[model samples]
Target chain A: MTQEVEMKEAQAPPSNSFSSASTPSTLQHLKEIASLIETGAYAKEVRRIVRAVRLTIMLRRKLKAATALAFINFALVQGSEAHAKLSAYLPKEDEHDMDVDTASSASQGFAKHALPEIEIYCYLLVLIFLIDQKRYDEAKACSSASIARLKNINRRTVDVLASRLYFYYSYSHELTNSLDEIRGNLLALHRMATLRRDELGQETLLNLLLRNYLHYNLYDQAEKLRSKAPRFEAHSNQQFCRYLFYLGKIRTIQLEYTDAKESLLQAARKAPVAARGFRIQCNKWAVIVRLLLGEIPERTVFMQKGMQKALTPYFELTNAVRIGDLELFKTVAEKFSSTFSSDRTNNLIVRLRHNVIRTGLRNISISYSRISLSDVAKKLRLDSSNPVADAESIVAKAIRDGAIDATIDHASRWMLSKETGDIYSTNEPQIAFHSRIAFCLNMHNEAVKALRFPPNSHKEKESAEKRRERQQQEQELAKHIAEDDDDDF
Target chain B: MDPRLVEVTQIFGRFKASLLRNDFVTSSNLLSQLKVLLTKFPSLPPSFQRTANAYEELQIAREIYEHAVLLSVKTEDQDAFERDFFQLKPFYADLKGLIPLSPQEYPILGLNLLRLLVQNRIAEFHTELELLSSDALENPCIKHAVELEQSFMEGAYNRVLSARQTVPHETYVYFMDLLAKTVRDEIAGCSEKAYDYLSIADAKTVLMFSSDQDLSNYVTEEHPEWEIKNGCVFFQKAKDSQPCKEIPSLHLINQTLSYARELERIV
Candidate 1:
C-alpha cells in the first residue's frame, strides 16, 4: 500500500498538494494491509485494517487521510464485488440513498449515531478522491453533498474545508463551461471569504474570477475587481505567480507595455521550475510585449531549458520581426496560425506586421541615400510593377513612425535619406522620453488608487475605537493643562 | 406557434422598419428587445414540432444579429458593431448545414474581413476566413479583402490604396476610407524626407487630397513641422533657420590627394 501511494504521488502533477510527508505508523499499517491482501488474508482481517485506517483519520491524522480513503475504497472493492453490481442496478438517486444508508449503519456500529462532522468529512474525502481520479461529475455530486451537510455543522473549524469544497464545485462548473453557474458560486464564495476575513480564500477566489473574466474577454470587469480586492500578500508562490501574470496580461491589453514587461518578467522568474507550461505562457507574452516596445527579445529567451519546443513558433515570429522580412513573417504567421489563435496572441502578432514594415524601411534608408519609389518597391518586394505609389506610402509611414529619416519627391518619385545631423537634433526624442515618464507616473498613480484595504473586521473596529478614545483623552489632558497655565498667569 | 416566436417576429419587423427609415435610436432599442426575446427562446425552440422550425428560428436570429451589426455600422458605434458581429458569428459558424445563408451573408462577412484588416487583427481575419466554404473565397466581397490583404502584406501600398475605389459593398466604404487615410499618412511622411518643399498643388496630389483647403487643413492639423508659404509647402523650416553643418573640406582634399597618388603609382 505504501508503494502504491508513492507511485500515485509520483504520477500526479507537480501542482498536486499530496506530496507532504505522512506519519510512519500509517505507512506501516498500510504496508501490512497490502501484504495481507497480497497473501490472500481473510475478509475479516482486511475489514479490521480498514476500520483501523478510518480511526487514524478520525483521530485527525490529516496527512494520511488520502491513503486511508484509498485503503477503504480498496477494501470495499475486494471484500464485496457485489457492491459494484448493486450500485449499477440502482438508479442514481437510489444508489446515493443506499450509499448513505450503508454509511449510517456502518457509523452506528462504530458510534451510537453518525456525527455530522464525520459525515461531512467522509463526503469531502470522497469528493477529493473523485477529483483526483478525474471523475468530475461524481466529484461535483460529492461536493454538493458535502456542502449541504456543512450547512448544519458548526463550520467554525471547517471553514477551510468548506472553501475547498466550493473551489472544487466551481472548478467542475468551469470544466463544464457553465459560466453563469461558476460566476454565481464564485461570487458567493468571495462574499463569504470577505466577511470572514479569509485572506487566502479571497485571493484564490479572486484569481478564479480573474480567470473567468479573461476567458470571456471581460478585461474591464477584471480591472474593477483588481482594484477592489483586498491587498494581502499571496501565501502561495503559485498564486503570486498567477496574480502577476494576470496583471501583466491586463496591462498589455491596455498598452502599458513597460509595466506589463516588468510584471511578466517577475512572473516568469518567480514561476516554479516544475510549472513549465505557466513559465512558457509568461515568456510568450513577455516576448510580444518586448516586440511591441521595439526591442528584440534576446535569443536566449527562446532557448530556456524545457521551453525550447514550446517557444519555437514565437522564436520564428521574433526572427521575422527582427529581420523585417514581410514575406517570411507572413509565412510564419500562416504556418503557426492555429497555435497563435489558441494562445489568443494572434491579435498581437498581427500588430507586428506594421513593426516588420517599419524595420524593413529603416534598414533600406540606412543603406541608400537616394532611391526611386519604384526601385524601393522592388527592393521591399511590394509589387512586381508600378509600385511607385505603394512604395511612397510605405516610406511615408516609416518617416511618420520615426523608423526612418527620409523624404519623398513627388515629380521624380525619389526618396532621399536625411543627413545624419538633421536626424539627431530633432526634439522628437525628448517628447518621446517625456511621454514615457508621464505614462509611468500615470500607472503609479493608478496602482496607488487600486490598493485595497481589508474589509471592516471586529479587530479593526476595536483598534479604531481605541484610537478615538485615546484622542479624546489627549484632548481632555490638553484642556486641563491650559487651565493650569491660566491659573499660573 | 410559440408565443416567443411571435414576439420575436414582431420585434424583428419593428427593427427592420426603423433601420429602413434610418431611425438608429429606435432601431437600436428594438435590437436590444429582440436580443432579450431571442435569449428567452430556446436555441432549438421546443414548441416547434419539426426540426425545420428550429432551423428557421436560427435563421431569423442570424438575420436579426446581422441587421444589428449593420445598424451599429451605420451609426458608427464600433463597440456595438463588435458585439453584434460576435453574436452573429455562431450562426455563420454552426448553422452551415442546417440552413444555408442568404446571399447578403458573403458581403457582410467580407465587410467584416475588411474591418479586421483595418483594425490589424490579421490572425482573427484568417480564422474567420478559414470558417468559410472554399467557394466563398471566390465571392467578389471576400476576394476584395483577400487581394487587399495580399497587397498590404506584400508592401503594395498602392494596390491597397487603390482598392478603396472597387470596394464591394457600401458598408465597406468606411473601412476603405480608413485604409486610404493610413496610406495617405504614409505618403506624407515620405514626402517630408525627399524634399525641402513642394508646390501646394503637388503636395495636394501626392497626399491624395481633393482640394487645396483639405491639403492645407491636413498639413495644419497633422504636420505641424510643415510650412505653407507662397504656394509651396516647405517640409523643413525657412532656409535661414535651418541648422548648417560645417563641411570638412581639408579632409576631403587630403583623401583626394591620397587617391591621386595611388592612381599615379598604379599607372
Candidate 2:
C-alpha cells in the first residue's frame, strides 16, 4: 500500500518529476507496478470494511475509496500503456475527474479512478444516464466520444457501447424533439439490429423508430418496418405488445380499419389485463373508430367495458362524457382537471366538457337549466386563451352543420416543430381530435408559442416561424371562444 | 248421397272412359270413392314388407321421392303425371292386377328446394364478399371461394359461348312443347281455359309445327305482315288498328330473363 501510494504521488506531478522514473530497471519496475495493483486490490478489501458504518455515513464517501482502489488495480493492469498515451492527451487524473463531473453531473464524484475501458464505459453510462436525466447536450458529447472509441474495438465491449449509443441517441433526439435525426439514428440502429439479428435489440430500435415515423406521418416506411417486425416470444410480451400497439396505429393510418381493429385488439390481448393503462388507450381508440364508423351499439359496449378497466385518468373522463354519463364525466373530469394543473390530458377533458356544455346550450330544447355551464367552464379554466376554445367552436359548428368537411388550416402554424411535425395533425377536424384538444388545454402557453411561426414565408425557416405565430394566435382565439365568450359559437 | 258428389262422379267417369271402353257408369260411384282414396294415400305404402310382392312395386314411388331429395333420379318424374299421381293415387291403384305404373311427381318442388340450396351456396359466396369488404380477403376460406367463383363464372361463360354454335335440336323441340304446356297450365291458373286461347295462339302455332326455321323466318311465318330489322320483328296491323307483332324467337330467347321476370310478376 505504501509503495502504491508512493508511485501515485510520484506520478501526480509529471513536470516536476521528469527524471524520477530512471530510478529502477525495466524488469524491477514492472514487478513494482504489479505489486502496487495487488496492494490496490487489498485496499478495496479495506474500504469494504468501512461500508458498514452507520446511516449517518454517506455511501458516496466509502464508494469513492473503493473506486480509488479499483482504479489503482486498473492502472496497474491495463492503464499503464493506455495512461502513457492518455497522459500526453489528457490532464492529470484528479483535474480530469473534476472537469467531467462538473460539466456532466456534479454527483459523478471521483470519476478519475475509472480505467480507460471503465472510463469509456463511464462515458457511455453517463450518456445514457444524462439522457434519462434529460441532459441531452451532455449525453450527446459523451455518446459521440464513446462511439468513436467503440469503432476502435472489436470485442463485446463495443457491442455494449453501441447498444448504449442507440439508447442515448434515441433519448437525446427525443428530448431535443429532433425527430428527423432521431429517425436517422433509429434507422441506423435498425440496421445494426439486422446485422446482430438480436430480437430484443431490433424490437427496441424499431419501436423508437416507428414512434418517430408515426409522429411524422411517415406511415408507409413505418408499415414496411412493421412487416419485418419479429414476433414476440412469451418472455418479451411487453415489447411485443408495444410493437403491435404501434403497428395498429400504422394500420389505421393506412386506412385498413378492420386490420387496424384486429391488430389493436391483439395488442390489447397480449398486454396484461392489469396493465389498464395500455388497455384503456387501446380500447378508447378502438371505440372511437367504431363510433365514427356509425357502430354506435358497439361503441357503447366497448366504452362500458373500458370504464371498468384501468384507463388513463384523462381517457376515463372524456369517455365518460362521450357516453353521456354526465354525472360520472363531471366527477372524473373535475377531479382530473384539478389534480393535473397543466397536464395535456387534463386540458383535453376540460375542452371536451366545455364543448358538451356548449352543445347542450345550443340544443336548449333539452333544457340544461339544471347545470351551471359557467361554473363548470371556470373550473376547467376554459377562460385561458388557448386551443380548447378554438377547437370547441370548430367542433360545435361542425356538429351543428352535421359534418366537418373543413380542413384545419391553422394546423400549419402549430405543427412546425423542428423535430416532429404536428403530433396533433389527425386530432383537428378528425376522429381523434382530443389529442390536439388536450395539447392545447395543457400548455396553452407552449401551444401559443409554437403557433408564433409566420404563415406566409417561402423559405422553410421563415415559414416555420410564421406558422408558429399563427398557431399561437389560433390557440389564444380558441381559448377566448371556449371561456369568456359564450356567445361566440 | 250429395248432388255435388254425383255430378263430380259423372264428370270423372266421362274422363276415365276415354282411356278404355265406355263401361264407366256401373262403377262410377266406386271409382269416385277410389279417387278419394288415391287423394288420401298419395305416397307409397309405409311398409313394403307388410304387403304382397305385387305391392313391393307399389312402393317404388316412395323410393323415387327420397331419391328426388338426393337429386339422383331425373328422367322419370313429370310435372303433370306427378299431379295426377297425387290427385288420383288410390283410383289408379285399384286395378292391382295391371302393371304397376310409375308415379309422376311435380319435380318443381324438388328443383325449388335445390334452388334454395343454391341460394345458400350464394349466401356463402356473399359471406366471402363480406370478408373481402372487411379486409379479411387474405383468409384461406375467402381465397378459396374467390378462386372457385372466378373459375365457375369463367367456365360458365365459355360453355355458354361454345354451346351457341351447336343447336340442341332434340332438347329444343322438347323444351318448346314443355313450354307450351307450362304456358297453358299457367294461363289456366290465371283464368278459364277459354280466356287463355287468345294469348297462347301464337305460341301454340310454333309448338304444333315440325318445320325448322331461323328466328327471322319463324317470326315471318308466324306473323306474315311482320318485318325483321335490327334483330327485331315488327308487324303492321290493319288500317284502323295499332300495330302489333310477335317478337322473334331469337330475340325472345335473348330476352328470356326479361320474359321470366315478367312471368314471375304475372304468376
A1-489: candidate 2 lDDT, tens digit per residue = 012123223333432333323322222232232333333334543221111111101111112211332333333233454333322222235523533333234223323443333444434333533443345676665555555565454433234334535555655665566667556556765776666655555666777777677555456567777787665553245556667778776655444557767778787777664455566566655543343332332334444453544335535554564454445667776676543333212322332443343333333313332223233234333333443332323222332333322211121211111122344442233324435544544574465556756465555655777779657756754554322211100
For candidate 1, write residues A1-489 as lDDT tens digits: 012233334444532443434333443454343433333223323333223223332322232333434333333332342234223222334323433344334433332223333333445545554554656676666566555555455434344445455656666655556655467667767877778776666777887788777766566668788988887877545567778988988877766789999999999998666566677889999999998788999999999998898899999999998888889999999999888877777766866776777777778888889888888877766644466766776776566556776777777889889766653354455446646755765676677789888576455557777779657756755554433222111
Q: How many backbone clashes are present in model 1?
A: 9
**Best candidate per lDDT, number?**
1
lDDT of 2 by residue, B1-267 (tens): 434334544544454453245343433344444445333332333322333333433443333232332221123224533443333333232334444433322222223222222233433233123212222334333333333333222111122222223322221233233334433233222222111122233323322334335434544554455454543333342332222344246643545565465446446
Ten-residue region with minimum lDDT total, candidate 1 chain A: A480-489
Measured with C-alpha atoms, the lDDT of residue A204 in candidate 2 is: 65
Q: What are the clash counts of all predictions, listed in order? A: 9, 22
Candidate 2 stretches greater than 4 Å from native: A1-123, A148-165, A228-235, A265-287, A290-489, B1-267
lDDT of 1 at A279: 78
Clashes of 2: 22
Best by TM-score: 1
Q: Which 10 consecutive residues of model 2 chain A have the lowest summed lDDT?
A: A50-59
